[model samples]
Target: MDINDLRSAVTLVSLLLFAGIAAWAWRPRNQAAFEDAARLPFSDEQGGQS
Candidate 1:
């Protein structure tokens, strides 16, 4: 009802939304690019050897 309450509610909603998005993004079907990126440093290291 007050400004402080409104601010708290908005903050809680945004936090929940961000958590949901993070969970969706971490699902297995969406992880291949993330895995590839995780491996990129190693790939670059190998490329530098040759």
Candidate 2:
């Protein structure tokens, strides 16, 4: 396809990818995991032996 067609396809794919990630991140099932990750910086390294 032409350059314009390729550009449009890439943009649409990127938008869909971003929307999917956003949905996944906001889903209720993942809330606890995301919250734990958000606390990584504040957690003590000794107790945080992953």
Candidate 3:
């Protein structure tokens, strides 16, 4: 119930949150969506018209 304990709890929560998001992003069901997002910057280009 001290400041250090609170800090440790916050750190643990943050780590768990990050891991969950990483797992979600790498799941097979999301591959296509992620790939499409990864290509978004180049999506506007067509037939080398730039």
lDDT of 1 by residue, 1-50 (tens): 99999999999999999999999988998799788988877875555644
Residue-level lDDT of model 2, residues 1-50, one tens digit each, is 89999999999999999999999988999999999999988887786656
Estimate the overall C-alpha local distance difference test score of candidate 2: 0.94
User: Distance (Å) between predicted and true CA of 8, model 2?
Assistant: 0.5
Candidate 2, after superposition: displacement of residue 12 in Å?
0.5
Per-model C-alpha lDDT, please?
0.89, 0.94, 0.93
TM-score of each: 0.59, 0.81, 0.82
lDDT of 3 by residue, 1-50 (tens): 99999999999999999999999998999999989999999877765753
Better of 1 and 3 by TM-score: 3
Off by over 4 Å in 1: 32-50
* TM value for model 2: 0.81
